[model samples]
Target: MPPATATTPAPPTAGATDRPGATGAPGRAVQVTWAVATIALVAVGTVRAAGWLFALCLVAAAVTGTLAVTGGRSPLGMLVAATLPPAATVRALSWAVRGLRDTRPAGAGIGVGRILKSLAISAGLLTLFGLLFSSADAVFADLLTGLLPDISPDGVVGWLLRLALIGGGLLGAAYLVSRPPDLEGLRPGPARPAHRLEWTLPLVLLDTLFAAFVLVQLTVFFGGAGHVLRTAGLTYAEYARGGFWQLLAVTALTLLVIAVAARRAPKTTRADRLLVRALLGTLAALSLVVVASALYRMQVYADAYGATRLRLFVTTVELWLGLLFVLVGVAVVRLRAAWLPRLVVGTAVLALLGLALVNPDRLIAERNVDRYLETGRLDVSYLSGLSADAVPALTRLPEPMRVCALGQIAAELPRDGLWGTNLGRERARRDLAAIPTTTGVTDCPGTRRW
Candidate 1:
């Protein structure tokens, strides 16, 4: 044999981390990856001129990223995990901080320091070149100007606040990844004995109240705003606006009451489950009618005042509530099923995604224009306030209205030089360019030309 040569022991296999019930703490690589992805999304949302929908995407991405970092497996559970409150996030963070007690060095002998130093050097050189290029191009310079931090007191304060919020949020997310939320409470469990009077008394009172309200809604729903206003000594707008928010409040309160009662409902016997089911089912059904009434009131209002992003979004929320009650009915029937909460949460997420896809600003413009076509009255002032996504729809309006709409939009649209990066702004600019002339509207201030 060759003269004795020392042989180093083989490093512990990477497989060691995957052994049964691994603590599931996010590795350094995972943490860095999640941080990069989240930062990229925020950068895109800022620099590319994305709309509210894109903002929502950022939130969803952040939530999903946090859940993944924590090692959550179920898609539905991930959805639920996204809703962890700040307090819960903090608690998890504390739990993760405790693990630091095992402070033995990780990645020992991997040349990690050398790798990090190389990465820093590469990044520094790249950034220096990027800054030089930004200085050389006027458009790129403008973008950099917009992106760079401002030195004013208000700007500094706002920036600091934003920085704090973002840092806190990331810390919370990292904590969540290490320890996902406990969701056992959402699952159906062994039936506990019920106190029938405690559950039913309030429910009976609530059911009666809701039933009476539904009776009143029949008149408003069929009799129309005119009849309700005339009978109640109020204007149509007053009746509609006043009742819309109030009904929403009522619906919210009723839902809360139902939730509390259901949580506390005795499920010891078949009869108890049936009774619980019957009361909750009845309340949910009645709530649907109330939701319909609220929707009708909103339609009446929108018809008179023109659609707005707020109104459109509110309509969507009511629709979601109606669907939720429908789901509740399903749950009432399958009382023993543990999947109802997950189903409800999944449905809500889908509903929100669908709303985002609808593009509320564009939809608002379309509805308003259609309303104008039918009634020959457009709220130019309101249409002017909408985002660039509304530009295409507004341009579709006929002649003088179209010219005026374009002028209003041009005034409000951001002239940020990165037009090519944003579909909405690019399309708006293109459409504005195509306008033959703003010739005829010289009388209307700021209504002259593209």
Candidate 2:
């Protein structure tokens, strides 16, 4: 008789499981590709100039790439997994590292040792020639000396640590792709049956509370400044400052509650589905009222104070939260939209890109300058601390204020001749240099500090 043939199970796709080593050759190939891409992203992000936009872009890329490696099939699932608290990543990393023990050898060799030896030989030749030329010519010696790295113990350790971190992160990502963690919780599972009465009672109670809150917001929102002062018994600035952040926090928490309730709620029957929609829709609508209140309060606060970067960020967050609630409403209407997660992520990415395009530093500077024109109180100290992008806007201020602003700005502007300067810094330097110095601003106290 013929020998019995053994059967090997295929690797898991989206909503399945694969034993260790069952991922096969294709999975390993994908792992290598994703690892290379992740490392490249991290390297570019690290070397790029530091800014809010650069940091945001780096984070977005790194996070999305990590999620893709984590076995998320749908864009929505990947995006959701990406935003999950750091605990999820830590768990996934731990599992990936543990899975390293199960790694099997490939049936091939790449002769990496030979490649390393060749690279070492080439480096040695280059070093020998460099040293010979430096010894023969003083200019060459200085140039080579400037180019040579200072190989101190601390420097070496730091460089090694950086390399290790990059290597380890890449390895971890590759391991995840090859052996994905058992994260059933992160998967988009079928909606479980929820008891209609069980969900209805709590949702109704929450809905009633939200309704009361909306009524109060309507009074404050439509009644104008006088109503706020009359009901809250505080000045507009005081009321604005006290209520906006609290309302924002409340709205955020409410959103979380609604999301959790809807996700866990059973919708087996038609009545259950309708009930879920009605409850979530009502909550979303009330949340919008709260969002509007938060925005209005922030506007009032910004009008009273000035538009700082922090305030602008909060305003953006509130707006984004409002958009999220709108998306939630849509999801409720559709009932089983797997596309919601992707929509949320896309909305967030667009918002972040919009913010980067707006250029917060310049926006803050311009708005502050306008505020100074109206109130005659330029926060010279604050303006000085802004990034180089604010220099042109600062030039628009009055003579002494302009001089003060430019002087403080010039202190931080890039002074490294021209070899390594960026366009933004160079532009700022030229604009500052164009400001003709006058004796009047010399008496300004802030200019003295500059």
Candidate 3:
């Protein structure tokens, strides 16, 4: 679908009350409340996560993701959107101030000189503000180290950070690309940035390679993109690390295609529009698969499971959103199909709002507050970067600690002496020895494995 023009945003609501087939209309407060609530949650989460580095990673993820979504192409939007709230959120917001400085949104249909001027200002502001908020060394050092210094090669944590940052960059790019177009001193789509083939050829080649890989995996291996990779028993981080190539490919392809489609998508007939609708739906489904795969990966790792695992693809979510938007878009285009548009939009809004309220994550977050809470063993290793933490966190655990300690204690005991627990038996023997009727020594119990 093409980008929303400066005209209208979505379907109408007033007409919806007359019709019964559509989803109900949600109050305006629904969206408003959700946004404020979400922002508050962000504030709380930033605090709960603790440490400037973690916050920065998140800021970077959010910043990048915002850049990509608002500017870049559709599939790019899809991919970034799918990975977000985790990878995207973590990195965009991590250096958000810096991201705003280093990377900012640009507009279309603007003259080259003016566009460049605006971009310069945007970039300068983002950079200046970023510097004010975050330090250089403070963040980079933490990226290489897990918050827990001990978990040297934190495969899971590191992978999460990596995926989020990468997604954020892609999202930011998409946002810029999808923007109307630079206006100042520019005709459209500049040519003399030094290299055309350098950009196009590489993108084309990378996208092609990814497509081929996805095709191979889909046909000969999994039957289709969704079946094998995200069947079940996967975790979010696992899927991210395990199927990153495919995820990246799908996201890139989707964004590129959508970008192209938006630019050239024909509107000759209702059928053409329908085709676009179908295409968007398919894309949405793919996005859902990407998300589902990620969620499943997380679930597997966390020993968690949920109902919406398969529906996680961003495409799926957006597909539903598009349906409502489509009615609005079509109604706007036709102008004659008036009464039904509002009703359709209102219903869709209500449905979408309802979905948000019923979102399993909202419930999950509420239900498992204890697990999400920050409390556990004396993990000083994370703060200290102990040599032992470099070993897998699971490797040197409660059982291992107990087993090793017990064995060392057993080795030093005298074989000839009656075996007894160090404290109890010795105390018993000593206490008994003071009594005339008591024996000289008390027999100790056999050594026991802890």
lDDT of each: 0.68, 0.69, 0.38
For residues 258-362, what per-residue lDDT tens digits would candidate 2 score against the true structure?
A: 777778887778977888899989999889988998998889877777777778888988999999998888888888656576566556656765666576778
Against the true structure, whose TM-score is highest?
Answer: 2
Distance (Å) between predicted and true CA of 67, model 2?
2.8
TM-score of each: 0.71, 0.73, 0.28
lDDT of 3 by residue, 194-218 (tens): 2333334444554456445545444
Give candidate 2 regions above 4 Å deviation. Answer: 1-53, 68-108, 111-192, 415-421, 436-450
Residue-level lDDT of model 1, residues 1-450, one tens digit each, is 779989999887774545221223534443354445545455444433336656765775565455445433333444455666465556755664555443446665434345556889998997798789897998987777676666579869977997877667766766654554543223345456447897799899989999999999997778877888888899657867888899888878877786667767887789888898899999999999999999999998888878877788788878888887887777666774344654554565566567655667778889989987888777776777677778878888887777777786776666543322566777778888887435567543221111
lDDT of 2 at 210: 82
TM-score winner between candidates 1 and 3: 1
lDDT of 3 at 426: 38
Better of 1 and 2 by lDDT: 2
**What is the descending lDDT order?**
2, 1, 3
